[model samples]
Target chain A: MLSIKNLHANIEGKEILKGINLEVNAGEVHAIMGPNGSGKSSLASVLAGRENYEVTEGEVWLDGKNLLDMKPEERAREGVFLAFQYPVEIPGVSNINFLRTALSEIRIHRNLPPLSAKEFLKMTKEKQELVEFEAKLANRSLNQGFSGGEKKRNEVFQLAMLDPKLSILDETDSGLDIDALRIVSNGINKLRSADNAFVLITHYQRLLEYIVPDFVHVLYNGQIVRSGTKELALELEEKGYDWLKEELQGQESINTK
Target chain B: MMEKDDMMLDELANKEYEFGFVTDIDMDISEVGLNEDTVRFISAKKNEPQWLLDWRMKGFKAFQKQEMPQWQNFKMPDIDFQSISYYAAPKKQAKYASLDEVDPELLRTFEKLGIPMSEQKQLAGVAVDVVFDSVSVSTTYKEHLNEMGIIFCSISEAVKNHPELVQKYLGTVVPHTDNTFASLNTAVFSDGSFVYIPKGVRCPMELSTYFRINAENTGQFERTLIIADEDSYVSYLEGCTAPMRDENQLHAAVVELIALKGAEIKYSTVQNWYPGDKDGKGGIFNFVTKRGACRGDHSKISWTQVETGSAITWKYPSLILQGDHSSGEFYSVAVTNNMQIADTGTKIHHIGANTKSRIISKGISAGRGQNSYRGLVQMGSKAKNARNFTQCDSLLIGDQCGAHTFPYIESKNNTATIEHEATTSKIGEDQVFYLNQRGIDAEQAIALIVNGYAKEVLNQLPMEFAVEAQKLLSLTLEGSVG
Candidate 1:
């Protein structure tokens, strides 16, 4: 469902994602693990079409469309969703209204009829239940005064509402408590389907316990150095990225020789 | 969505003033100058009685002693008062018996401005008084207003017919010597709406006045007076537009409202004077003095205004709570875009015991526009247990725009409770990106954010106007951001 070839991205002329390559098929969950500044979030931002991250060399294809050529909104309409790690607080815009506008825009792109207010409301209620988002939060300004947990849950609620084809969860468990982590993971688990895929980007192996991934890739020095099954996450949790750093150093020295 | 948003923004950025076309009707315009002769000419043209003419002379004298104000945040080129034509009225019969007798060109002007003036197409349950340049051209729903003993007519007509009512309330709330602009407006004011709701009577319909500036190089100085007698209620709305001109025109209007014991008065204004082109070469300098006096116990007055135009706007709609337990409220949304400048707010004087006031102001600045909120809240020594709550919020769309807030709160009584809160926010790239990531374009994103910012004040406008004000807000800020 998604492909990234030699993804080289930069910010302020400093390269971040250097020679990164990845791919994911339908119905598969892929976990990209990395330490601080490993370009995990940068990769997500590049895929989402953030203007600041200039893609020096890359090709990102979603389904059959060239994703790199699309605008941020176009990427969204093409079913590429990025759950921002730090959600923007947009006061005065109600969550319900924002969701409705997004849904309408997506529907227009698909050449489908717009949802009526009643149908939209019903859909919102159902999604709210799925994500366990508080009902009152829907009427307030979009994440204006929402707590950290509420914001994350709201992002999941949006994911459910949008139902994107390829969902990239960028550190969705970074600031979650035990209960919030459970709720967020439960919501993601429920959203898992046979036709869609998810890219779980995280630093800790804790989230892998809830939404187990079919493949785990360790990203170091802007490159995915290793790939294995779910057992790789358990091994990393027991050791840490320190072992991975040493392994990369050994491989670099051998290549130079 | 991206292309469509850009197109809409381009259209709004280059939107021409739809009401810029001038009617071909002959005008009775005064010579270019300001003096005793100019004031007398205006009064004489209106056929004012001796007392009113004397009032004009007093105002003229007072204006001579006052220098132009210099304390505002906006910059202004020195106004050439001597070169401005003080009065310009459409040459027609003093009183039109019906719509048929009015000039077709003048009627077409109204139609183009979307002002429903004909009785058949008039807004239901609303009385409209149309003021063209400096004269009241036609007043609709007069017979309906007369049946309820509600005297709604031109101020000049009020002076001739309801002289007692006019004399009692004229300049009562805003005196001729109030300020430089106030005195100037009083001295050469031509004509505006006059509304009087009798005691114990609620007005049968909303009272509205549409003021249009047509003649070039002429200053529109209109005087409006509305009196809500004891135990009465009335909602008055005023709208303004002007023809496009290269040289900046002056509009110094004075509106005085009086609410007697147990009465309530609601005054709303949607000021859309031309804001000049993108370079801000020509437009209107709107210097208005509007004040409401709650003269009897328990009287209430509210001022709601949406200011989106005018190259230079210096206005303060004030409320004087002179009666015990009186209340005053001011809700305003001011948008300045593309080199426009606006310094507007409200003044609340709590002079009576237990009086209260609430002020909500939203200032949105875009492009190189500058917006400022200068408000004054005073609690007198005798105003025991008075309360005032003020909230001022500003939204800056781009780095070039500016927003300023100057709040003056003076409480002589220790028992008064005054609270003021202010916030300044920018339309950050992240906010726009977030909306875009949700499939909403930048234009709609900014519009949504701005509308949310101004929702509190927009909610205060009357129903029909709220919709128009919302659209105007979007129109004013379109293409303001890159």
Candidate 2:
């Protein structure tokens, strides 16, 4: 459902994500783990088509569409959703109104009929229950004064409403408590289908315990250097990444000799 | 005076007029001149009584000799009084006994501006008096108000029927010699609203006036007076929108109010006059003086205004707290867009002890517009324990526009306590980025921020007027963002 080839990216003239390649098919969860400034979040941002990130060399496709050329809203309408690490706070604009406008814009892009007020409200309630979000927050201003956990749950709730083909979760577990992480993971697990995919970006293995990943990839510097089964995350959790770095140095010396 | 002299000496000083337009309406306009004879001509044409004519003559005398005051934030061109037509009315008899008699040209003009006229004009409610140029063409729901002993009618008709009431409160709050504009309005004011609420009566509906300017080169000097007797309550709203015109129209208006013991009056104004183009050429030079006096204990007067038009606007709707425990409040949101210049604020004079006053003003300037908030809060020696709170905020949409605040505070007694707060900022690109990420466009984003900034004042307007004000802000902000 999504593919990236030699993704080279930079921000403000500093190289970040370099020569990164990955592929995730439907019904699969891929967790990309790395240390600080290791391009884990940069890969997610580049995939989501956020501006200000200069792509020197890259190719990213979502559902067979060129994601790099599309505008942010166009990418969103094409079923590519990015759950931002830091969601924007739009004061005075109600959350429901914002979601409805987004939903309508997507519907118009796909030639689907717009949802009426009744249908929209009913769907919103179902999503709130599924994501365990505070129902009262829907009518308030978008993300204004929202707690950390509430913001994460709202992202999942929106995920449920849009039913996107691919959702890149960027540090979704950063500020959430144990229960909130479980709720967000469960919401993602329930929304999982053979026709959809998710690229979970995080440094910890705790989230994988709930939404079990199909594969694990370790991002180092600017590229994916290691790919293994879900067991690899548990291994990294126990031994840490120093062993991998030591092994890489040994391999480089052997190759030089 | 120094500023005036500078403006006069600047040879390249050319004020561009943007909205120079004249709708296709049959008009009966007086020749251009400023004198007692011109006042008599207007009074005689309106069939005014002998006392009213004599009063107009007195106002004219005051207007002719009175020098225009300086010390203002705005710069006015030397007005050729000889070049201004004093009177102009729709050919349709300036009087309408019923809605059915309303002129088609007037209705079409309102439709062009998207002003709802009937009950459905607003979903919440609409009780409007549609005025054309210098006359009240039609007033809605007057009979019901009359049943409750509330007298709401055109000033000219009031002088004819309720002579005693008109003679009693006409200039009681602001006299004929109050200021330059007030003196002029008092001199040749052709028509406007006159409202009287009897003792112990509550007005049944919200009273509103929609002023339309359909003539070219004609100054609309309309006077409005509202009096609430002992134990009475009333809310009055006035708004105006003129079609684009090139020649500058002079509108110097005076509104006076008198509140007896235990009475309350709330006045709201949403003035969207035709503002000039970016170069500042042709538009209305609005000079207005409005004042309300709380004559008895426990009386209250509140003024809420949203000003978004006029090439040059100079007005201060003031209140005189004359009785013990009397209260006065002013809430204002002034938006000057597209070379519009607005110099406005309020004056709260505490004459009685223990009086209170509050002032809140929000000014937004966009597209080379110059907006200023000038206000005063003064306390008399006997006004012991007088309290005043003033807050002023300005938001600039672009670097070219300017926003200013000048507040004058005076206290004679040590017991008088006053506090002031002011802030200024521009609508930065970061704010727009956040809103746009949520799928809202730039225009909608600016409008939302502006409305939020002006929420306190917008809340004072009737729901319909509030919506219209929002739309006005949006249109005014269009092409204003860099």
- Pick out the ten consecutive residues of candidate 1 chain A with the lowest summed lDDT: A90-99
lDDT of 1 by residue, A1-257 (tens): 89999999999899999998898999999999988999999999999988888899979889989999998999999888899999999877888888998999999998989999999999999998998888998888999999988899899999999999999999999999999999999999999999999999998899999999999999988889889989999999999989889988998899999
- Segments in model 2 whose C-alpha atoms lie over 4 Å from true places: A1-28, A38-71, A100-120, A153-165, A190-196, A215-257, B1-22, B65-69, B97-100, B119-125, B425-428, B479-482
- The Cα error of candidate 2 at residue B194, in Å, is 1.4
Q: Could you say which candidate leads in lDDT? A: 1
User: DockQ scores for all the models shown?
Assistant: 0.48, 0.16
User: What is the total number of backbone clashes in candidate 1?
Assistant: 0
Q: Name the best candidate (by TM-score).
A: 1
Writing each residue's lDDT as its tens digit, candidate 1 over B1-482 gives 34443554455568676557777889877889988988888888778999999998989999999988889997666898999998887777646888888888988888887887766544466778888887777777788778889999999999999999988889988988899999998888888888899999998677888888889899888889999999999999888777788899999999999999999999999999988987888999999999999999999999999999899999999999999999999999999987899999999999999999999999999877899999999999999999999999999876677999999999899999999999998988788889889888767778878888888888888787788787778767765543
Q: Quote model 2's TM-score.
A: 0.86
Report the poorest 10 consecutive residues by lDDT, candidate 2 chain A.
A86-95
Sort candidate 1 into its docking category.
acceptable
Flag clash pairs in model 1: none
Model 1 off-target regions past 4 Å? B1-28, B91-125
